[model samples]
Target: MAMYAYKDAARTVKILARDAQKQDKSNRYYCPNHKCDAHMFIRNIEGVSASYFGAIHSHGHINNCPHGASNRFNPNDYDEDTFEFDNALLALTMPGMSQTKKELPGEHGSGNAKASPPRTIRQIYSMCKAHDCSDTYNGVKIGKMLLDNRSVYMYPKGVFGWRIIEAKCKRPHFYNSIKKEISLIASTAGEEYTFILKFESEKLFKEIKNVIFLNRECFTVVAGQWSSSGTFNVFCTTFLSKKQLAIIN
Candidate 1:
C-alpha cells in the first residue's frame, strides 16, 4: 500500500499497542493467520515507533514470543482496546477502508498512478508476482522504504472507465515548441484515443505536480521517490485509459 494511503495508519498501531500491553512472557502476540508465523514479530515494528513517535516501545524481549511458540491475536478475546487497535491498523488496509475517487486505478487511468506508461489489465496480471505481481507480495522493506513502492495491485471491483494519452518531450525547448492543439484535450476520456508521450531529453531535475496546457483539463503526476540516485529526463503527458478486473470495492 502507498504510505500516503496510511496517513492515518498510526491510529491503527495504537490499537496494537493496547492489545500488546497486557501480555506477559507466557502470552505473546502472534499472527492470527494460522499459516504464517514468520511475520509474527510485529513488536519489532513497535520499537521503531517508540524511538520516533513517542515514549512507548516494548522490546520483543518483553513480549517473550521469542520468534515462535506464541499465542495468536484473537480480537474476540478483547474489547475497547483491541478494537481501537484493529480499527486503526485496518485503516491502512483496503479491507479496513473504503475507496475514494482520488485513488483512481492507475494502470490505464483506471484512476490509479504509476511510473511506467500505463498498462492493460491482461498485461498487468501476466507480470504479477512478488514485486511486480500481486499474489506473491510480502511487504518487507529496505531502510524505511517498502522495496516495491512502484507496484500496484487491484482487487475485483465494478466497471471502471478512462482513457490514456501520454507524450513526453526530452528537451525543454521541445516542450515550448509543441502547439496548443498538441496539448489541449477532449472534453472527456470517452472522446479520445491513446495519447502517448515519449519525449527524448529534458533539462530539469525537479518533481512535476501537474502539467497544464491550452485546455483547462489536467493530468496529475503523482509524486514518488526513487530507490537510487539517477538523473531522469523528459517532459511527460497522458490522456485517459481504463481496464476492469477489480471485483472488491
Candidate 2:
C-alpha cells in the first residue's frame, strides 16, 4: 500500500507517502479518492514505504475506494502497472474534468487560463517538503542568499516530455568563437518548457547527441543545475540513468 495523492488545507498536491507527515494535522491531508475517507495524518507511517494514503488499515473505507491491496470482488487477476513519481505528480497538478475546457492541462499555454506561475526550484522544494526546507537552507551557503534575495536556484533532478531538437550557436565573447548548445522542447498537454543544453564535450553530451538528439520526438530526462534566473546552466549538467528516461517513448 502506498499514498498516491494528498490534499493539504492550503494546497492539493500528489506526493510520496513520506511527505504526508509534514502536513498540518489539525486540518490534515486527505486521500485523493473521493470515497476514501482515510486521512493521511493518521495513515502516515514513517520509514515504511508500504503505508500510504489509500492503503488498507484499521480504519476502513467504502467499497468504491481503489486503494484496497487486492480486489476481492473481482475473481480474475490483472496486471499492476508501474509509474514514475514525476508522471504521478503531473497528474495531481492537472485540472479536473469539471474545470473549463480552456484550462486544459500542462504547465503553460492557454492565454485566457490563469495558470500558476512557474515555481523556482526552491519554491517547488519548499512546497513538497516544508519541514525539511529550512534544514536545506541551513545546509548550503547559498540558502541564505536565496531567502534574502527571493531568488530560485534550479538544481535539475530530471526533465520530462521533451526531446532533443538540435545544437545551436550562442553568442560568444569578443575574443572567443560562438559556443554550441543543445535544444529541446515539450509541448504535449499544453505545457511548454524548453531545454537549452549548455554544451560540453563530455561522454554524456555525446550520448545525448547520438541517442536523443538524433531521434525525432523522443522523450529524455536530464539532471543539472540552473542559474537564479532559471536558465539551464549546461556546464552543471548531470546525466540521468537509463531507468529515468526508459518510460519515455
Candidate 3:
C-alpha cells in the first residue's frame, strides 16, 4: 500500500488517498515512485481504518521499485555496512550535494566503482521505524526525540541530518505565506512539542504546503539543521531542500 500517488501523468504533483477520495473519480493516479509506470487506484475499504493507493493488478510496479512489495524492511538481510555513509558531513549538507558521483573509464570494472545513490529522508525514516528508533548507522542515531524542554537542552543549535518528528496534532497549527513559515506539533514519550519550519525558497515551501494540505494527519521526517531558542521555540535553518521533508502516515 502506498500513502502517496502522482496527481497527473507527468507526475509533478503528489496526492494522498485521503484527499484523492474527495477529487473526481475520473482523475488518473500513478505510482509514487517516479521510476515506475504502474497505475494506481484509491482503495478505501468500507471497514478499514485508513485509505491508501493500491497498484492495479494489470499494471504492477517495475521490478526494482521499492514499493513493489509490502515486505517489512530487515536490516539483517543486507550487509551491516550497507547504509553506512561515506561522508557523514557531506550527507548532512543540502540535497544536491549528496548525489552519486560519476564513474571514470576503468572505475566500472576495476575495484573502484561509482558511488551509490544517496539515501532519501524517507529511507532513513523507514529504518528508524523498523528498528523502533534504536538503530544507529555511522554514528548517526536513528530514534525518536521529544519536543520538550529536555530536547532544547540537548540540541540547542538544532539537529542535523534526517530525523523523525512524530506529529502530535492531526493538522498544522500555523502557516504564514509572507514569512514562509509552518508550525507543527510533535510528541515523544507522551509529551507534545511544537516547532516552526521556515522555508528559504518559495518553490520548496509550495511543495511542502501541498503535502501538508493533503495529508493533515500524517507526520514528517525533516532533514537539515534544527535549532531551539526556548522550550517552545524550535525551528529549522535555511540549509533545507524539498528532498529534506517527507510527510508520511
Best by the lDDT measure? 3
Q: Itemize residue pairs with steric clashes in candidate 3.
A: 158-226
Candidate 3 regions exceeding 4 Å error are: 1-72, 76-118, 144-162, 168-172, 188-190, 230-233
| TM per candidate | 0.18, 0.29, 0.50
Q: lDDT (0-100) at residue 217 of candidate 2? A: 48
What is candidate 1's lDDT per residue for 1-249, written digit by digit as tens? Answer: 111010121322222322233242123233322233322222323222210011123422223221122222211111212222122222322222343433423322232213231122222221121111121212322111111112211211110122111222222232333431122111222222212222222321111212332211322111111121121221123211112111110
Q: What C-alpha lDDT do the candidate models reach, one value each?
A: 0.21, 0.33, 0.52
Which sections of candidate 2 miss by over 4 Å?
1-50, 54-179, 186-193, 202-204, 214-218, 228-249
Top model number, TM-score: 3
Q: CA lDDT of 7 in candidate 2?
A: 60
Cα lDDT for residue 81, candidate 3: 56
For residues 1-249, write the lDDT of model 3, one tens digit per residue: 455677777877767555666454555588756788877777665454345566778888887454554322323222325455424323644656543323211112122233232255544444344331232444444442222222433444454433445443334356678988777765545444555677788887777777776776656545544566355535444535665566665
What lDDT score is found at residue 242 in candidate 2?
22
Error of 2 at 208 (Å): 1.3
Clashes of each: 38, 2, 1
Error of 3 at 137 (Å): 3.2
